[model samples]
Target chain A: MESQNIKKKSVRKAGLLSLIPGLGQMYNGQQLKGFAFLAVTIAFLIELVTIGIPAFQDFVTLGTVPIRDHSLFLLVKGTLQIIITFVFLMVLILNVSDARQVAKQYNTLGYVNRSARSMLKNIWENGFPYLLTIPAYFVMLFVIVFPVLVTLLMAFTNYDFYHIPPAKLIDWVGLQNFVNMFFLSAYRSTFVSVLGWTIIWTLLATTGQITLGILTAVITNQKFIIGKKFFRIIFLLPWAIPAFVTIMSFSNMFNDSIGAINQQVLGLLNYIPFVHVSDIPWKTDPFWTKTALIMIQTWLGFPYIFVMVTGVLQSIPDDLYEAANIDGANAIQKFTKITLPMILFATAPVFITQYTFNFNNFSIIYLFNSGGPGDVGGGAGSTDILISWIYKLTTGTSPQYALASAVTIVISIIVIGVSLLTFKKTHAFSNEEMM
Target chain B: MRGILSSTKFNRFFSRFLTYLFLIVLSIIIIYPLLITVQSAFNASDLTAFTLDLHMHWTLANFQQLFTQTLYLTWFKNTMIIAVSTMIIQVIIVTLAGYTYSRYRFKGRKNGLIFFLVIQMVPTMAALTAYFVLGLIINGLDQYWFLTMVYVGGGIPMNTWLMKGYFDTIPRDLDESARIDGAGHLRILWQINLPLAMPMIAVQALWAFMGPFGDYLLSAFLLRSPENMTVAVGLQQFIADPTNQRVAMFAAGSFLISIPIVILFFLLQRNFQSGLTAGGTKG
Candidate 1:
């Protein structure tokens, strides 16, 4: 498809010209795009020079007398500025490459230099994807990326309650918070125990949901079952309701003095053999609270699994089961060999995500009991998982920002690590062939 | 052996009975909390009402008090505004992004996809410190718009992935033909791909709407004033405060809020199932 007649423009020269942000695009006859890129990059640079540099310098030199007291603010602002600048630099590079590629395309097409209007038309046709995605990028940059960067930066500074910004400067402590959390303080024990509970909760909640879900799905899928639609809708109630509403309602229902569970449900249980109860103290008692939380999670989680497994169950070919039956395989054998493996294989990635979700299941812990029935001298509660513990550390009376940030980093690592490992194993990220 | 099995017909009856029993019991367990919430909302009690005493006086006092004595209406209004706005914004952004990612073979596309996947792993609360700092800078604390922005932003990564997956299933020949007909990219996306992917889009919109409707922590953090608070945060105050144990009123409020959502869920149950399973069993 290479054209022999057109004079080819040097891609390298075009790329070099893009150091001015739009020059290369202009050379490639993409005036509007080049100008747009140039304008945005220049505006970003201008902001960086006038405001970002001063803040960054203050961060580096620890500031002079007037601004010295605002070190934390300056540091955070400067770091954010640097991140934005880096983003623009990447954009600049992208601009250069894009320009070079367009020029080469033109050369191949036998078009020496397209007219300005046709160039605009080309952009409107081919550049639509980039144009459409700009808003998404803006949202991601400001909302997710910027905040995450600030949190990461905050981990290195002593920006806790004692170092309230603008009132007292928060200095860079250089892994001191991590040291304190791991080795130097009581927080070490809390972190360890919370991590332990987090894992335990994730395992129990996830497995319980999957087990109950599969059981229900198997039963509901039975031809013997009547009123299948009614049962399905009823079963989905727990999942259909907003989780926070149900969680909070459960919290009240588990109240020892006035709660329905203690007042009516357990009161009836007292009549059963070997069962005696004054009250269960469902939320206040550490053991019961954790157990109740697990049960509640199971109730909340199983329906989704039920729905998924049901879908998988329906999709499973009847011929396999028919073959097993022909071979004289019993119902239990067919289930164990056929249904179980197929469902697990199909939904393994979902199950892993469910595990990860339960690991960070903050609302259930926080909303139910505020991570309460306090344990270990108010640093955390009995039900406090890692995410809830982080919440408490950040929002509690002492507001330990650095410690919280460190914990956040730890949680991110565990979550990301598990997700990556599981995604690889399950081939969750593999591409589906287009139909 | 055949005669012996044929003689034990009662065993088959018992097994079928057990299955039904198990299902019925589990359904009750699942629906019990909802029943209690509904009952409590109508029960005329100033405090926690646990008894099954259906003969007790039923009144609309709790609902009346919920409307008149609290900022319930304001909170409801605020939540509706946020949920609707977030839904619209998130749908638009993710639709465009998803279409772009699906149809385009641009530079950095692979890295961009990986970036989104990695970003999804980072929980939003992990970046609370940054959001707090940002709120202070933008003078956005206590504002619904800022909270809306956060919700829309937070929903994009996962929703975009979902939408892109849905888009992939729609044959590209449609877009090719549209281009042949001289339709532009936007027209093809809006007219061709979108109509086919309507189920997934509806699912995304529902989730986006429900996210802010149910979110407690972020709303509580970003919005401080009572009037500005969303329903989730506002309802929690009834039970959260030590001095004010308003369980019945909270129940009433919860019931009221749940009606529309439950109706929506039932109406779109099929779409919900297909969307979730498709998104789940696929990428």
Candidate 2:
């Protein structure tokens, strides 16, 4: 009973000490952890005072002195500082909570006498996971997360052609870029058409590939099928080749006059009386361009789904099909009831991601035709999806960084929303994690 | 009854023949361009035409020109540097992180995984200016290491999840028993886990190595100098101007790059099957 008072007192004392960032661990006799935590917190504070606060100020104002202070630099630096601070605060919280928890553990289990060597051993053994992952998080914090934040923040700024930094400063113009994309007269057509095509492309191209893949898998996996290995190799060829090469080749092949598609293959069709149109204008005509893009994508993408479905197909129990046959079910019935659902169930995540992939399939669109076949008046071409258009805006001589960022955020929202939906639907894929 | 039996036999034969025929036609569609590429690279006559001709006018000139007239060697070296760096870093980080997520049920493991998922879904190309700005800040603009890190960063989240999934299929009893034997965590991972996870690691390594070969959008955005350009970006310049496209040379370059990768893909077929089922791309 009396020992309870002492235990409670230690817990409260540890909690109080932890408010100073590392004192609690020292009190708990985790001397190294205590010192490391204190060191990190101090280092963080040093960085925060020296650069973080100033960067925050810069982020807020963008730039006060145009020639001297580059707003773009300030924006990037400030976003990095904010990310660093967030990481620091998270560590600080962990430190404090860790102190309280360790104190409680000692009270319950009874404190063991600690030596310096034992303390180091304990750290190596206990902190192994953190040791492994910290380096990765540190790398990701700058490389992936930093850029994302800058793009997201840039959406609310006017960092376009005229307002570029060093020569001129960009200021916050919240949602004006999006407003112009939707409500304004000039951009509305391009924006709507590009978005509509993006949706159409994602649905048609991804589904078309998956459907073709499934069909090929079913045919090739037939019990009596010969040379299965050879067919698999051949089908895998499209995916095995680098995508840019294939896209580049397809782009060359789709040329109206020089390309074999027009000069040879379509020429044979032109000899037919009703189909006597000499040229299809595969590049110059937007409709044919879109059609060619979809066909090329279907060709490029089908092999992956084929490989995936083939794996799933082989794994399906033969007994289920036998049972269906016994029930006097036809081939289509057995497929619809068993094969299709099983493959779809196994590959649902791939389908979602493939949609995301084709939605932003920049290489296929850009390398194929540079998203051309339309006037550049509205900052996009006839074949331009939002992602390709964003690329053009970001890469052009006078890049519209603000507008591109706005589009990126929109893509992010759609992609993230779909991924999140998949996540929820899959129930976080617990993966036997509870074990 | 005998007539019906013969009819059924005939029907079976017809269906089997149709299946074979359909497969053959599809194979032709996919393989014809590849055949054209090979033919053009050797044909000597063709410069820009994607010909379907079977006639031979073969020469080693296109490959010879690619190495001499262009910066193809330099581009190949640049691509190898980036791909190899990204692959090495990706393998190390992914295996380490995979071990942690699989073996340890530490604080925020679930949350961190989900956070990474959300972050991973954001397309790498979406942050174009930020990448430019980041390259500038790090003095990495046009630098191979910069592009390598971006590749590592872009691929890490998905690769880590895939690795973890692979690791999960590995039994925990081995590790638990190793822990009882007083083996250190690193020792356990090195001796038992890594040896067991070799297949997944191979898949991961191969995918990472191939990424730089096809990447144009980001490489183009970050790299400015001709000396630093990767093969994908370098080869495109051959065909960039409509009037000056050297299609034969482009074919030669792609032929060299694609054939070896295709061979590797075939060799790693089973490893790839499992890896994709666990949700990693061919990459």
Candidate 2's TM-score reads 0.95
Best candidate, TM-score-wise? Answer: 2
Which residue runs does candidate 1 get wrong by more than 4 Å? A1-6, A17-45, A61-69, A112-114, A273-278, A433-435
Q: What is the DockQ score, from 0 to 1, of model 1?
A: 0.62
**Candidate 1 lDDT tens digits, A65-151:** 533457656766787778877988888888988888888877777553356677677768777878988999899888988888878
Interface Cα RMSD of candidate 2: 2.8
For model 2, residues B55-92, the per-residue Cα lDDT tens digits are 67789999999998899989988888888898899889
Give the Cα lDDT of each candidate. 0.83, 0.85
Q: Write the per-residue lDDT of candidate 2 for residues A347-388, one digit (tens) a residue.
A: 776677788889989999999999989864567988998888
What DockQ would you assign to candidate 2?
0.59
